[model samples]
Target chain A: MNEVSKPIPVADAETAPYWDGCREGRLLIQQCADCRRRRFPPHRLCPHCHSANADWVEATGRGKVYSWIVVNHPVPKEVYREEVPYVVALIELEEGVRMVSNIVGCDPHDVAADMPVSVFFEPADGGMVLPRFRPATGAA
Target chain B: MYGLRDKYAIAGVGETAYTRNSGVPVLDLAVEACLNAARDAGVDVKDVDGIVSYNFGDSAPAIAVATALGIPNVGYAVDFAGGGNAANLITLSAAAAMEAGLAKKVLCFRAMNGRSGFRLGGGREMLARGVTQHTAPFGWITYPQAMAMWARRHIVKYGTSAEEFGSVAVTFRENASLNERAMQRAPITMDDYLASRFIVEPFRMLDICLESDGACAVLMTDAARAKDMAKKPVYIMGGAYGGGPDQGEDLFDAIRWPDHSENYAAYIADDLWKSAGVGPRDVDVAQIYDCFTYSVLMQLEGFGFAKPGEAGAYCASGAIRRDGELPLNTHGGLLSEAYIHGFNHVVEAVRQLRGECGPRQVEGAEIALTTAGAMTCGSAMVLRN
Candidate 1:
């Protein structure tokens, strides 16, 4: 694995493992051990049952674009100053969790709400393979 | 609603002046707001046992204010949400903290000299903020600019007008003239609103919320003790703070109907109404969030006052006018009163219910509903006599 790029801001202790999966080219979400409920954007405890007992579950990374906006403005310099208008979208994983990720490999206009898409990671200028998303169709 | 209603009321409310780069510190604004709210409530500093605030400007452990003011032992503590969200959060927390045997007398506050204290500019500094970096860099820069995209879609879908939008500004300015705390009390006409320069295409400069240094507070004790207190006991009938975390298909897509407050305001109203077992019918007045006039229009639909696409007409009918069937923004609201986030809305609701407003007050207001929108979180509360 390449060197880790940006440090996780809000993620801590219990959320570490989920971030770890991203480095390994895997999308891991949280699943409550007791309630059989799945959670996204990793947290320390299960929000459904407030149970601390949970496990990291690998996700299929395929879902629909719930809502999105085409960003034409210059990006924040700290993140990236590229002036490219990219589609920033919230992807709802098939496993029933929504995570915000940049939609890559398509024109900004091509993206739409509820459009099927799948997760794909790419190498960044830095060492990390940034987790992004691409349009997809239902298939095996 | 009558007995002890005028006893332990809001005797005083204070705030630091808001400016783009007001050199004054943010903490100073919070202290000012706290002091003003106490004055509005007519309570002494030492009498405040509970400390509650929506976390925006102040740090956690707000006892610092208590310590600074020589009032020791802030028995209650809270820091939740950002933006004007703290309005309901502080109130609900203070009310419950008092009800659940946490603290007897509580102070609920939100203060931020956002523009001056930190200069809420849209660049690198914004990236460090919670979700400011998320949509901001991608062309959705300012809060109103982000909402403007949806506003355009609404105009297209429903055929709303610039004139209609201006009416909201006019009404707010009219009411705010009576609010000594408001930054802009000058009269504005639809001609002026329509003529104002545009900030985000369809949205003009007036469409955006002011960036100011201001604070607001509310004091609470259980209904039992409130009866013996100084002012009218504006009873908390119901309250809720919640929103959707769902990211379904199209989660990333900008809204078609464009309920910008999909997560917070709508649900806050629904849940609060459900919990109180009362609908909008029970409300005599509404202190809806007015970060933008569109927000008020959107909330009117969200809170069940009007149907979607009908807010333009509802507002145009002067329904939300100060003398309409259901008065709104009686204290001028954020649009004119002061952008104390949404905290000022709650304070005004209490004022109207108590019939405390001299000229701007809504006559004989009994039940009032106040709502707010956090980034995506929202909260609302119902107050009754």
Candidate 2:
């Protein structure tokens, strides 16, 4: 595989805390204070109740594979050409929120829908750490 | 109530030759298409007073096209800031303008050198924005990969197979063989579709749309003035645009969208049929936006042509062929024809309604349906001759 670095996540004002949580090896999601609904990719207001008041809560990091794709054609070839056929999936957390992440620790072809997965952190470009998912084990 | 139905008509449609390299400025293509549309309608260019176009910052502005066309005075002009989803909306906006007495002879068009310049599939830095910020770090950087995830969800939920998706590609290619304007006219079978390399899991190269350089334009006016035009007018029966619940301002926000298998079509289908005063069974032909083969399947289910989880079988059963019950993509769609940002689909629908598609024509096709975009926010319209 090529040694080139991958694109790091650029955190904006709304998503800074989520990245902060990832840097600390915690999976954080926003929960609306009004309706008690949780959401991902941190936003300004609750999509459900339109409340601007929300707080970041540490998640269980346990999710199921809702959907996934094995990308064979990689763009930004320098960064991903060596990672062809990597599995990228939408993980539906136990809290009922979905987010995008990589399905590691298993064969890309073996990944299936509803497969239970748990999150782990990995170092990325520029000292940034990203949250990825792998098949869940009995522990946590 | 339903006031826009049959109130305005597309009097003429025009398209430049679909090519990988137009070798001209986008403005030139826009002007060429506008002139061709005016000529097709027998409407003097000097009398054209309004313009509408859409792009992702890759096309000429409406005012620039108007300046090129030399319209003495522009009564109304606007450009939507989007891609394929804006195709039908531009026409709808133009028709609404005419209905509101804001302008007459409004020309709606889309022009792009998609192959030679600013390719949708190419590696561009701007694509890594918004929701992509969360996914791009994991090598999920392009549209096909994101859409493939949705396609995979459909497969898991509905038992959709690769062969079934391939059937859509095969059918459109068959239709394209009869279309001289199509970019990939050489016929391909289901075997060829299966053999094509995968771009992403559940999506082969054949299943994806062509990246083409082209332009398409349609002229709209009041129904009264349409009767005097050079060609038979295709009335704008009804249409709807925008997103539904769970669809945020960002594109492909599948994380918040409740069902990955469902598309924007489901939310708007009822309104589309209700306003058109016609059911899915009444459509004689359909030009479904086929940015990807699975998109066609999703729209088929979304538009009520087939029940959810049944579009795969419906397509594989030869139901979308020209001789089938619901002739679809008669001009080969974006898959085999060319991608003019779905504007070409509108042009083909107008031609089919006018009986101008000599070889690929649906015999006596009176009513047609055309959809734009998939996954994200979308739009659709019904047309009648």
Candidate 3:
């Protein structure tokens, strides 16, 4: 597949730590101090317990494809046309938080629900290392 | 407990020709629909004092419509957020205004050049806050992608196949084929639906709504005054609009929420049915939002038409077809008909109850249920002749 110009994510106060972990090859998520539940897309308050107190924890980075889509349409940037058909997957991590990411290292059509995956960091636009998922078997 | 129930009636309904490209500004479409509705209601354009449009910010503002139509002044104008939610909320807003004696005649409309002008297909920012901050970076930008995830999960859990989803497309196409105003009137078979291209996996091209350039408008007033109007006033039996918990949160993250299938439609079911003093059996026709085919399937179960995991089979059984027990989307809906957001559904619901739909009219249709799509929020209206 041709390299598509991917949109780089700018880290914000709530999500910066997660991006920082991706840069360092650590899959980090927020853990609620009150209920001890983990969450993705870091927020100020815990969605489960509604507690404001939370801390970061490194994840195992292993997950299963809860659901997926093969996007046949063009992506945001014009450069993404070269990669017309790409895999956009929702991965349910072992820690029980589901996050959206691309499934690399496999044919776009070959990916299916419940496929095993692992998080990997790749250099993206803006000198940022983005975390994407790949087949757990290291197919690429 | 719904005080506005049966107090207000739809005085008039008007729609511009549904097309893919109008080549005119959305403002023009707004004026045409609003003026047509005013003319249909037998009310002078200068007499309309209240105006309301959904807060999409893509269409002509209420004041803009009023100014274009030469209205003297505006009273009780509102433009609230949420696209499909505005379908019922705007009408309900008009009803509330009439109840409060704020305005006599109220105009509610939705106008968009969705295909030729401003397209919802692109990944460009639509809503800037909340979900976009997380989903956009991953190319999870459009509604199809988000809704596809929901469909995919539903399929995995219920063994719902693509054929079942295609049935909805076929059913709507059949309905739209009889509707001359619908954008796509060609009948589609299940094979055609299965053969269609996939914009997003689990959601074929046929499953998504057409992005058309058109608009639809409705006029509302007190039920007692509507008795002498140009057309039969479709009384609003009961209506409700609300959302479930964490509606804006990531869908996949909350797979464990009480009942995974309980969307806003499911959550608001009790209020909708109870206030209307009717059940699923009493609904002669239903215009459930068809932004995507799976949504129709979900809403079928959400509104208590079928048990969870049984809607797919219920659809396959041809219950939603024209001659079926519960005729749905008789005007083809957004899937085949023009996507005037969800306002087109409202117009179709009114027309069916009025017996104006000659070929596709549901026999003895006395009550119609019009619903908006499930878009982080939803709204529903139960109307009776």
Candidate 4:
């Protein structure tokens, strides 16, 4: 057991599989087995249909920058100092599911709405891989 | 739906001086506010059997306040969890308890030492758990970030300009100059607002609310019992608390994800007016919760003061000024006034209805509307003199 200096995702029973999928370089989304609608941030019962039964499915990992905010102030935290003035964006996947992640591999100021992006995994401090996004440069 | 309409009235409102440093404990602030509220209502501390506050862990609990006040017992007490979302709910709970004979004199209050002790925006945590695990790891930990997202989407859709956002901060600062208790009273121009540094893109330094050390408390009782109180009663004409689409279960997925132009308050806009038996035009003053300037724009749309993409123009035309069609946030709101969550707005609503806000008062103000935090879980109330 090791301590992680940065805040990492503490996966509970409901979200463990999704985090596990991220570690495997796959973006896992929840699809209701009955209603067959997709959801993000993981849930037990289907948010759309209230069906207790659901399945983990891999997503295309491609989304558009639905909206974003470039934080210019330095948060009063030692761990977040290096990441000052970072862009935190709501990336909406092609499946119509949205997730919050940081935009990397591009200038934070260059981020814009409807800009194409793709999921990219980074090794976090907790020996786990966290899913992030980079600007989509090539064709789907 | 309107059964509780006018059933309760705010008998008294009290608050500690807004300051950057209180040099006291949060519990002390809470007790001071409660005692002042009880005195304002001409009620003894012993008569307050119902105590209610927000569920946020910042303030002293209801039982803590009662114990410190030397009350023997409490018939009803609840601490709701949402921040500004719980402002009006605290009073609504007190009113309901008093009307049901659960308690005679109910005390609702909020106290915080945000500047001296802990700043709500100075760290990497959300008020509630689970919602920010995905975001906080990436420094997306503050409310302004979410609000920035909402603002950018609105701008892209409606062709809103940064000048529109500056107008909101400028209006609040202008009103704050008239409020002696306001934290920022230097006054600002649209040029000053434009030149301010950006905290979160689309939101400048002036777009955010001030973090001050203060407290606000109000006493609630039945309308019939309010006539016997010392001050003139401010009746609770109507109130509603509710949530909108996709906010229920997971809480992570929003109704329209990045586009949060629609809010929970809009769902109950008609219901609130119908309950109060008035329309938006009847509101003489408004104290809208303004965590960010853009949020005020969203709320104007949600509460039907302006059409979806028209709030920017509406505000730009000076319609929300102190002498405008709607004298909004006359106490300067959180942008310039102290932020005790949204409780300060409620106190201002009561003052406007009673015609106690001297320089910033809305002329012939018979009705007032105060809205809690918007976009997420929220609440609103209509008050009448």
Candidate 5:
């Protein structure tokens, strides 16, 4: 994949911590202080309990492939042309929130629904890091 | 309750020739379509007091189109935000304006050089904006990829085979073959669909909608006034728009959307049927949005035409074919017809009701349903002659 031309994510105040966690090789997600529920794409208010109180808690960084697609069409950039046939998946995290990421370290055809996976941070353009997933080790 | 039922009517519908490149400014396409609608309705352009349109920052604004068409003294005008999701709502808003005595004749249009100018196809710069910023870094940056994820989930959950999804493409292609205005009018078989290259896994090239440069317009007025129009009036029976919980989130944000299998149709189906005083079975034809083939399956189930998870089997049964129980996308839909971003679907519905679709016209068609947008917040309308 052409990592040099790949777009890097810009973080706002609400999402800065999550990116910060990625840079430090940790996965962070917002946990509602009142409902004790976890949410991705950090926000101030809890959607479940409508609570403004929340905390950035470390995640297990493990999940199952809920669904995925092998992208053959290079979109948003011609740089992705070489990256065609990459697996972009929705990972249902252990904490009960789902996220968009790539399933690396495996053949695109090998990824399947309910396949257990774990997260790893990868450096990107600029000083940003991205959380991507791969097949879990020693797990069903 | 149901006060708008048959109160306003679509007196005329018009369109520029569906093409890959119009070779004209977006305003010219808009004016041509608006004037054609006025000619079709036999109404003077100056009489159109209200103008409404919707776009994703791609089309000529309603006021600009009004000025170009020389429609004097526009009393009410609105340019709705978003894309196909606002297709039905824009027409409904015009009807609302008519009902409130804000305007006499309203013109609703969608004009864009979707192919030649600002394409809906995502670009590198677009990836840096809004929610896409989060997904772009991972190479998740296009509508087909996002929708394919949902299609994958539906297939896994329901065992909906890829062949069943191809059935929609084949059937719509057959319909398009009869439509001279369709961009993809060649007949395609299920084999053609399956053999097509995958834009995203679970979504082949045939499964995605065409991007064409075109425009469509519809004229709306009170039923009493429509009685004197040139063409048969297709009454606005009823409709619904908006979404359920977490619908405000971006289409790719499946994190907050509780059910990937269900779309906004499920949430608004009850209101749509109740207000129309008709069930799904009562409709003779439908123009379900076909941003992707799987979306047609999801809507078939959500709108009560098929049971949950059975829409695949329903399509495979040839129910959406021209002579089938519920003929769909008689003008070939966005999949085959020019994608005017679902506004053309509304045009097809109006034409079907008026018996103007020539060879592809549904037999004995009186009622038709048209839906816009597949995921996130969307809209649907029920119309009849």
Candidate 6:
């Protein structure tokens, strides 16, 4: 695994199970047992229904390019300098969750809003897999 | 408007120098001014039990400040997570805490040299971490970039020109020059605004705010508790907060289904108005955020002060000047003043209500309306003496 100081997400009893699932390389989202609406970053309750009844399920990992920004500038000294001028975006995951992520396999300028994309997990620091995006096959 | 009427008073205000090249640490500067606020309010640091700031806050500022001021068992502490809305959000939270009796005094602040320290314009770090993973590649890389694209669409609809956009920069400088706290305090002409070097095409260097390493803070407390403090209390008549347009499926999705009419820029204006239980005409003094010139323009229209494109003309008419009917950003603004997000705007509003600002003071100032900028998630307060 690549060396890193590793971000220990605030994983307590409420979040432990979620991280355990991520360790298995499966994307899980919280949905209101009552409303059946999906939400991201794993919360305690449903934003819509406020129901507590819920379970974990694998996401299809298919989403469209909702909004994005192409970062092509100098690197912050604190971060990996080798990753300079990369394209970072805000992907609206198919699960109705918006996450900050980077779009790989393309130039920064090529990123377009509404572009079809899918998740492609990449090896990250601290023996974990990070979610990234790639252009979907035959996507608009 | 976040319900500020004489319900609470801003007892003190302080700031550090605004400069990007300064080698000072951001947290130290922030703490320095916070302690200064303690003195300005005619109280010792030990009196501080409530501290509310932006979620973007660094722990160093508050933690070190607590230790330095000998404030023990802080009854209230929070960091509201929203960009640009830091000051206003803090105000709302402070007022709430005061109303709840959780604390007798609350201090709100924003401190950073995002320009000097973070180098957000570089965007490389945010990109590497893959934050904002799906925005736009060729465009919308930074705040100005994202706003520029939004502005492009408005120009097409409103027939507003780049020069019209330039008017925001001109107004900011005109007001900032008179403000000693402002960084880019220089006399600016419309021609100079247009002709100045372009940082982003159509967005001139003059149009953007300065990058500075500084911190600013304001102290607010219950209206009753304020009487014993050094400064008179400014009531919190109203307070409101609004969100920005939801992340649409596509850029066209945003443009096609703009829930926030051009009159209010985006949804935050709608949220603020609803919270205040009033509309645009209720505002007496205005302190609209000015991260860039267009931010002010969009906010003016978004807040329903004018029509979509009418902001350009309204600003040009000197209505937003320091001495104008709707005096604005009398401490300059992020553009001319230090860019500690929108923190200073709140302080300036309090000064207006207290009648402390001599030449820039708006006489008989009773109410102040402040708004955070686009992608809006800020709190607005109507303050009256």
Q: What is the C-alpha RMSD of each candidate to the true structure, in Å?
A: 6.4, 2.1, 3.2, 2.3, 2.0, 6.8
* Tens digits of per-residue lDDT for model 2, B273-384: 9889999999999999899999999999999999999999999999999999999999999999998989999999999998989989899999999999888678899999
**Please, what are the lDDT tens digits per residue for candidate 3 over residues B176-277?**
999899889989889999999988887899999999899889999888889888898999999888767756554323333333344568877788888788
- What DockQ does each candidate score versus the true complex, computed on alpha carbons? 0.10, 0.56, 0.40, 0.52, 0.58, 0.08
Q: Cα miss at B288, model 1 (Å)?
A: 0.9
On lDDT, the leading prediction is 2
RMSD of 1: 6.4
**Model 4 residue B83 lDDT?**
78
Better by lDDT, candidate 6 or 2: 2
Reference-based TM-score of each model: 0.71, 0.97, 0.93, 0.95, 0.97, 0.71
Q: List ranges where model 6 is wrong by over 4 Å.
A: A1-140, B1-5, B55-61, B126-131, B136-140, B244-279
TM-score of chain A of each: 0.83, 0.91, 0.89, 0.92, 0.92, 0.81
Per-residue CA lDDT of model 1 for A44-117, tens digit only, reads 77767889888888899898876565554333434444634566665678998666677777887787667888
- Greater-TM-score candidate between 1 and 3: 3
Error of 3 at B51 (Å): 1.0
Candidate with more favorable, higher TM-score: 2 or 4:
2
Identify the candidate with maximal DockQ. Answer: 5
How large an RMSD does model 5 have?
2.0
Off by over 4 Å in 4: A1-4, B125-129, B248-258
TM-score, candidate 1, is 0.71
Model 3 pairs whose backbones collide? none
lDDT of 1 at B171: 83
Model 3 regions more than 4 Å off: A1-5, A47-51, A137-140, B126-130, B249-262
Give the worst 10-residue stretch by lDDT in candidate 6 chain B: B125-134
TM-score of chain A, model number 1: 0.83
Cα miss at A11, model 5 (Å)? 0.9
Better of 5 and 6 by DockQ: 5
